[model samples]
Every structure is written in C-alpha cells, then in structure tokens.
Target: MEDSETHNLKRETIEQQYKTVRERTSNFNSYTSGGSHVMEYGSTSIKAEKIYLYQGFDPASVNFPPNELSHDTQMEAINQRDADILFLWHMYKNSEDGSKKKEILKQISETMRHRIHLDGSIDLIGTVLYGPAKGSVILNTIREPGLPLVDDWQCLKSMVRLFETHCGSLTQYGMKHMRAFANICNSDVSQSAMEEACVAACSSSHDPTQWHPSNHGYSA
Candidate 1:
C-alpha cells in the first residue's frame, strides 16, 4: 500500500513520462525521400517537401491572378513565416519578464490565427499554445495591414523572446530543412511534396517554435 503523497508523485511521474513519449512519437515514422526535408525519430520518418518551396520564395513576388493566393501557396507561406516568427518569439521569452512573455505569446497567437485563416488549420498544439491574444492580433493585422495590430517595437520585442526560447540552438541543417519547407510552400509543390517538407521540418530539429511544421504535412 502507498501513501497518498507517494501515490500522487508516482502518478505525476508517469504522466510526465507519457507526455514525453507522446511528443517523441507524434511525428515519428512519418518520412518521405527525394525531397528537401526529412523527419526521423527512432526508426520512424516523415517527409516534408512543401515547406522547402515556401521558405525559398518571396511572398510579395507571388502573383495571384486577381484572387487570393491558392491554398497550397498560402500554406507554404504561413508555415515558413511562422517558423521565423516562432523562432523569434521563443528568443524573447527567455530574456523577458513573465508578464512580457505572456504578452508576446498573445501576439504570436494572433499572428498564428491570421496565418491559419489564410492557409486553413495549422498544427493543433501550436495553435492552442499561442492562444487567443495572438489569434486576435492576426485577425486585426490582416484586416488592416498598415494599421498596426501591436506596436512594431512590441512585435520585435516578442520576436526576440521567441528566438531565445525556441530557435536559440537551431542547427544549420535544421535551418536548411525549415527553409526548404518554406520554399515548397511557395512553389507548386504536390501534396506528397508538402508532406515530405513537413516531415523534414519536424525531424530536422526539435524547437518550441517549430512545433507543428509536420502537423499539416500529412493533412495535405
């Protein structure tokens, strides 16, 4: 028989271990070859190729023929851009106060929402973590591009926090993979390509900012 406290502690430890295993396995065993990115955990692999084009192309340069960008193109842009933003937001969190970090999280959430509206659903975990504040900001930003959702300085401040927290130790290979996915998003990459790109983004490295790079890959 175990005491209440010991039982609680055991439960907590098991929960933590379970969470770790889930995270490790979430994107595991999903991979694709002949593309720009590769995601591998243990013996599993997920390939993400769409992101490669998204990262490489300039959003402004894309011509949309008097209509909004296509779903694929938009997704590519959002994934690549979010990766950069996430990297920045993570950096800011590490150096700032809790209050400031919370504010940054709000902004990120808003931006993420805006990207989602444009590109459709994103990685569910990333969407949930960023929360409503950032989601609202994204809405406002898209509504009035030049009107200032939050102060530019505030946005920059948040980005710094993101970099510190998430993208601080990103490897060159990881960056390459991320950029590859971005490029794929920007190009006319196929569903398979997109899947491969997402997998690559996931497997290339683990960072807080890059939580969902591969989440939407399979959906495509």
Candidate 2:
C-alpha cells in the first residue's frame, strides 16, 4: 500500500510538470506533442514579450480612450471619417520618431482631406466625461448629425454591433501587424482572413447621408 501511494504521487508530479512544459513552449509550431497539444483559451502559456514585440501595444493604449465606446454618455459624435482612421492617425503622430510621425500625419491628413471632398463633411462627434480625478473622451462614428433623440435599446444594439464589427476589426488589425512583425523576425506567423473581413464590413456600414457639411447646415 505504501509503495503504491508513493508511485501515484510521483506520477501526478510528473504529469503536472509535463503540463507546465507544454504551456511554456507551445507557441512554437515545432513543439507539438500530438493532436492534444493545442493551447486553450485563458491559457497563460502565451508570452507577452512575444505578442508585444510582434504587435506593439493595444490600439487603445497607444491612441487613448479608443474610437469605439458604449452608449452610456450624454453626447456622441458622428463623423464622416471612420474611427480607425483617427486611431491610426493618432498612433502615427505620437510615434517615437519625429520624422516618421510627420510623414504618417501628412498621409492621414491628406486622406482625411480627400474624404471630406468626397463626402462633403468633416464633422466628428464625441462624448465628454467629467470626473474629479480625471476626465475621459469616448468617440464613435455617428450615423447621423444634430443629435436626434435615440431609443435606448436601438442605441445599445447599434453599439453592440459596432463593437462586434468595428472594434473587432481593429483588434484583428493589431494581430495582423503582429504577424507581420513576427514574419520580419523570421517566425512562421501568417496573415488572417479577419483583416479583409473587417475592412469590408466597416466600409459597408458607412452612410452617405452622414457626410459632413450638409447643405442644410452650411453652404459649400
């Protein structure tokens, strides 16, 4: 009986060690150990160093408050330009190198200027949140202008879909950038279909009526 118990304890310890080893080295494709070695969700085996060096930081971290938000604010801004454009613009502007920042900002400004001509509006809508310690600004694409009263349920639904479609795409873009970085590093990372799907879905959500400088509000 003593011998049996000792053997079982050793078996359990070995099993735990094996699991730990699998988790630590699982990111490399060559480390597979049968069909059961797939990493599970919420697993910590993924290295933050690998992800960060590959993808940089979250867009929100670099861009501030993110371009997508919930509908729990007093005001929301609608703009003719996609929120991701602004996010990218901000990222480029705040990049570490001054010359690179200027180049990116110029590209974004030119793109925005062209979009304003095509759409006839350059309006942006955003919410202001005030607090004692600090304040935050949450911005999102408004489907219309002049703050038409919105149904709460409808707003919630729209926000959900916006997050699911728009913000999700941004996250996928970060992932793609990460994959590109990994490739540069000689890692076997591959591009994702999610990147293409995100672009198509975001483009489809755009409404022409939301164009800036509406004739009713201002003269061309």
Candidate 3:
C-alpha cells in the first residue's frame, strides 16, 4: 500500500516539512544602511530587493541566484480602474435627495472614495468602512511614520488633519473614540455637518490653545 517516500511523507510532521524547506535558505542574512536619500528606504525592503535582484546582487563579490520576476495570478488586465465603486452604491440606493449626495461626493477626496465598500448591505457600512486598509485613512493617523513598531501611512493624512481642524487634538482617552470618527466618515453627512458634529462633541474636552492646525503636519 505504501512506497518508501510515501510512507516517509505519511509519518512526517508539518514541523519536519517546514524545517526541511527552511534549511535551503538557512544561511541567508541581510543588512542595510539607512537609505539612498532622506525620503527613501534602504535595501531590506521589496522595491530595493527587486532592484538588487534585477541588477544581480554583488554584496562583497559572491554571485548568488537572482530573483525571477513574479508571475503571480495572471488575470484580465485592468488599467486605472476605480479601486472601489460600490462604497457609494448603497448610499445612493437609499437616499432620495440627489443634490445632497453629489455634494457629499464632491467634498470627499478622490483617494478616500476608493477605500469604501458597502457591497453586502446598508447595515454593514460601518463594519466594511473600518475593515483592514479601508480603515487606514483615519486610524493610521494617531502614530507617526518611522517610529518603532508603528507604520508609515502618509496617504490618509488629510482626513486626520480635518479631524484636528474641527475636533481638538486627541489624548489617550480621546483616541478611544476612533471608531466614532470612523462612523462619521462612513455616514453620508456633508462636510459641514461632519465639522459641526466634530466640534460639538470634541472641542470643549481639551484646551483649545494646545491643539493647532500646524501640529497635524507632524513636523513636531
């Protein structure tokens, strides 16, 4: 019923298979100097890795195998398609006031619009808006870039700055209301309505003098 390789495979644990596979690259190591420029990163990341691999890695002088170009998941070509079209589809379906919907769309940045997806139901709007990279426009703002154990997400910087311009700057306690902010963002409220809500709820809690429009730039 079993040949030697088949018998061995049956007896082998997942840990053994993992170890066997990982041993191929056991000697691999990497090191990086800061970066090519003040705004750029060093050789340890994927884009830099691509460059090094394409040029043939020559750290010291030994030539290792170069990385082949990835041929992952070949599919229909799509160029410059809207990243998400369905974010507003549900809102449009439910709302009767056409002018108000257009006004809301005009106020949101084109970049932020691509992140929303309410495909399932109108009820799931809050959940989908806060999901994964979808939520990054707001949540990623609390931490700064290049900090230890934190991410550098500069894309959604405007949304956070808008928060500060209306709502006061957040403390540890105020940061707890991040979901509430996310909800406001998901809701089809006008920019003026959102600003009014932010100020009404958030302005009085903190000293107004400390929170400045300048601080949102993270230059401090």
Candidate 4:
C-alpha cells in the first residue's frame, strides 16, 4: 500500500497525523524489506534492509523507516526473505528526466531479481503505487514495458483504507483528499468505462481523473 501527497499538507499537519498513526496503530508492524527509510507503526519501527549496491544503485532503496537493523542480522534473515507484497514508488510523468527514470527502474528490477536469487525461492505480489491523478498514466506505461501494475480503482480503495485507518487525524484539506478517494471507490466504475471517459476527455482536450494490470490476472 502507498500514501502521501507531493505537496498538499503543512509540515505541522503532516507531523500531527503521522503522530496519530504511530500512536494508534501499535499492533501493526510496518516493514521495508529492501527499503532503507525510517518507518514506524505504533511503538515498532522497521527499517529497510540495506543491500550491496549495483554500480552504486540500490534497487530496494525506494525509501524506508524508523528502525535500524544490523548488517549481520539482515544477512542472516536473507533466507527468511519475508516479503509477500511489493509496492514501487513514483511515476515517469512526475519525472523531469524520463530516460534516467527508466534507467533507474530497470536497475531496480535487475537488482531485485538478483536479491531474490540470493534469498532463495520466493513469490511476490507487485504493484505500482502512486497518486490518483497520475494513476492511469502509470498503469499504462508500466504495462507497456511488460511490468504489471495494479488497477486504478483497486489502488484507490487500498489508499482510502490506508487514510481512514492510519491518517484519519489529517487536516480538513487532507481529509478532503481522502474523501475524494473514497468517492472514487463508491463510484463503482469499471476500468474499461473509465478508459472510455478518459478518451472522450482527451478528444475534448479536457483531462479527467488520471490514471491496470496483467494477464496473470487477479484471483479475487
């Protein structure tokens, strides 16, 4: 699952909401398998694992959390390879340099493959996580490159629950954003129908809600 706006909340407001989640969600433990940023859930902090870099690039370095794990501990747990879900960050549309962005993604995928090999056999459920406006663009682009992305509506629903359960203390403006996502879920629209509307919007030179998956298909 993914959350956050590029620039919609005041620093204080963001911190307040984050504090609420950390204080309330004490039962949930957030982990960043290959991520190296600080993340906290309740009193627990899970740090992303640090992997040896490939030409100075760490594919798992998308961002991570509040806890730090020692290198020996991380290495010992390599056989555990505890991830079942993978959420990738950002989008090409948000990138100022598309070529470099694509290169980074390519390296990330390669590095992940290498890590998996070292970790032994495993299975993963992967999704491209991003904001709503760029959702459609990201889904299509990632699929065109043969990488499966989560469906837009599915993504919105996941995001809505994330906000309600974890970030409910957000400011009024931030709450409005969460409500907007909830509205999308309640719309009960299909991807094909939304795609048609998007095409119509483009024909009229208007942009509607911006922002699918692969043949592996969702068993749901």
Candidate 5:
C-alpha cells in the first residue's frame, strides 16, 4: 500500500494544489529569447523542480514581492512535498540592494533549513539584461569562483571553438555565453560575412586573437 500521506490525499486534491503553484510561478516568464537573462538555463542544468522569480519586494513594504512565495506559501509548498531543493538568485542594480536580498535569502534558509540548497548573486549580468526590477532563479550548486570571465562574447566562432575545446571545464555561465553566441551566428545572414565579423569581433575581444577558421571547425 502507498504511504499514509499519499493514501490520504485524493487525486483531485493533488492536481488542484499542483495547478495553483504552477499558476503562481508562471507570471515570471522568460524574455523574448528562450529564457530570461540566461538564468533560465538552470531549468536544464540543475533539473529545477520549481523555478521562481523574485520580482522585488511587495508594494506595501520593502520586502519580498506580494506575488512571491511568502512564509506561509513556502510552508504550504513544503507540506505538499513540492520541492527538495530551494534555490535563490538576487538580481539587483547595485550592491546595496543585493545585500538586502541576501537578508531575504537568509530568512528563507533559516525557515527551510536543509531543504535549501543554493543561493547567490545572479551578478550584474541579470541586471544588465533584464533591468533592475526583475527576479532571478535560485538553486543549490557549488559555483567555483574565478572560473573565467567573458568580456565580449559577440564572437560566435571563437565561442563555438571554446565550446568544442573546453566543453568539459565550461561552467553554467560559460554555457550561457555559448548559447548566446550560437544564436547570433545562426541568425539569418550570410555565412561568410558573419564568420568574418565573428572572427574580427573575437580577435578584438581576446588579445592575441584566438579566432581561426580551422579552430572553429570551418575550412577556409
């Protein structure tokens, strides 16, 4: 026989509860692209159970947004056994606001305890892409510091080469860059012109010019 908790709940009750939570999270959809600020890639990388976007504090107060998961809502989620890992990402224009979001993260961590897995700054990248008033996804994962920084990723061929060569070492952030690069290169345009442009841009971005036709899996 199934466990008592599962046995007790009717099929209808489970479906209704799942529907409610899904509706609540759907508000923060991704931008025009496949995902939001590249963070949406988390759904693929971490096998996210539930993705929530923190859309700033509530209008009535300078805290978590009204639409966001409140203490009660979180407890409800827990009671329903909806999630195993809790992730939080703060997207802020400046360091001060980022600090405030950290406080919220702390609160959630304390309340949820071991269930909480990962939280951190979505970095200035989210702010740059989505503006200040936006929410970032959260999850638990160990991000190795100083992995690498992408200054100008406008170079598609170089990026593709990096993806091909360093596929093993590339982090989530690096993969996002690779996705963005592929998008640009695959856009409707002349292949020669785009490749030349990409090579030029890559050379400009990386000193000593890392772009070569051969390296990019293309024959001159």
Candidate 6:
C-alpha cells in the first residue's frame, strides 16, 4: 500500500516493492498490496506471511504476524523517536557552555541514533516501536489511498521546535555547519584550544529568540 508516488524507497525498498501480490491471469485479476495485508486472487486470500518461500525469509522465523496490519503505530513511533533525539540535540547545541556543546556534538552518528529496547535491551533500531516494518501501509508515505489526513502529526511541533526557536538566528544557521564542526573536532585540537578559538571567534552569546545577526552578533 505504501507508495511514495516516486521510487524514494529506503532500507526496505525490496520488500516494499511487492509487499503483496494479486494473481492476475485468469477469471479474476487480483492484486495484492500492503494495504489489505493479504494476497488475493478471485476467491483466494492469504496472509502475507503465508507465502514464505524464496522471499529471503527463513521459514523458522516469523515477524510480527499478529500485528502486521497495525504498522502505522511503528511509523508513529519513528516520528516520536526522531523528535526525542532532536530535542536532546537541541539542548546540547544550545548549551550555555561552549566547551560542553562542542564536546557533545563530536559523538559519531552511531551514538546519536542509539535507542533502548522496551524489554530493557539495547539496539540501534530498538524494539521500542514494538511493530515490524513489514506489511505496513503508511510505513513510508501515504499508503492508504487518499488518507493522508489520517497521519498523526502531534509531534510535528516538537520535531520543528528547535528550528522555530532559533529561526533566522546564527544558532539556526549552525545546523548547516555540521561538516565544519566535524572538521574542527577531527583536527586534534585540545578542548581548551577549541574553547579559546570559539571565544575568540564568536565573542558573544546568541539569543536564539532575536535574529538580528548584525545587532546580536554570532553565537559560539
């Protein structure tokens, strides 16, 4: 059911390509898609998991068979998780102390994407979502036909809060300086030296609420 309307597929591109199949040879031309969560042809209907041969799935293992149709929850979880991450990052970036902000930003992407499982375990793609990526309708985009309005956007504000707070300010613009920050971090400069450099260069703290770059000056 998921169609970006374009081929903007990601990690599960292959699986999503033909999530469900509809037999279309004789009598009834049935097509399967993630929406119905089943493969159908005329009168025949089968769960997506039932066709577990040569699709790269191990017959011994099963995904969330009981909740294949509810993967919208998983997508919601992803949005929430991303929002949480950005919140932490926003605080780190807006830290009053220059050295602390620089130190926190140096961690690699691996550390930034970390999440903990619901069962007290840890993994990058943790089980917190508690839903499988397969057999999802809105897993990537508007999978359900004409149901884009149904998408949960409660966290939309949280997702953009940081940007909104620093809009038109140098702090907002700092998001674009990712590579520059990375280069400085990798330049082997000592913490004291980096702080000194930031102090010398910025010379003032930014008030994210005020966007007069010329008047407020740059932030460290």
**Candidates' TM-scores?**
0.20, 0.20, 0.26, 0.18, 0.25, 0.21
Give me candidate 5's TM-score against the actual structure. 0.25
> lDDT of each structure?
0.34, 0.34, 0.37, 0.33, 0.32, 0.32
- Candidate 5 lDDT, 2-53, residue by residue in tens: 1112222222233333444444343233222222231232234323222212
Q: How much lDDT does candidate 3 score?
A: 0.37
**If both were scored by TM-score, which would come out higher, candidate 4 or candidate 6?**
6
> In model 2, which range of ten residues has the least summed lDDT?
121-130
Best by TM-score: 3
lDDT for model 6 comes to 0.32
Q: lDDT by residue for model 3 over 101-207, one digit each (tens)?
A: 77656534432421221111111322344444454444334434664322222322333445555544432323444444444444343455545544544454433
Off by more than 4 A, model 5: 1-12, 23-188, 207-220
| Poorest lDDT segment (10 consecutive residues) of candidate 6 | 116-125
lDDT of 4: 0.33
Shift of residue 31 alpha carbon in model 6, Å:
29
Instruction: Give me the runs in candidate 4 sitting further than 4 Å from their true place.
Output: 1-23, 27-88, 91-93, 121-220
Question: Using lDDT as the measure, which candidate wins?
Answer: 3
Q: Which residue ranges in model 6 land beyond 4 Å of their true spot?
A: 2-173, 208-220
Q: Which stretches of candidate 3 lie over 4 Å from their true place?
A: 1-159, 170-179, 216-220
Per-residue lDDT of model 2, residues 34-62, tens digit only: 21254445555543223234233344343
Of candidates 4 and 3, the better by lDDT = 3
Error of 2 at 68 (Å): 19
Q: What is the clash count for each candidate, in the order shown?
A: 66, 6, 0, 10, 6, 5
**Candidate number that wins on lDDT, 3 or 6:** 3
Instruction: State how far residue 180 of model 4 sits from its true place (Å).
Output: 46
Over the stretch 79-185, how does candidate 6's per-residue lDDT look in tens digits? 33255457668878678878777766754242332221111111111111212343121212233466432233332222222222232222332333333333333
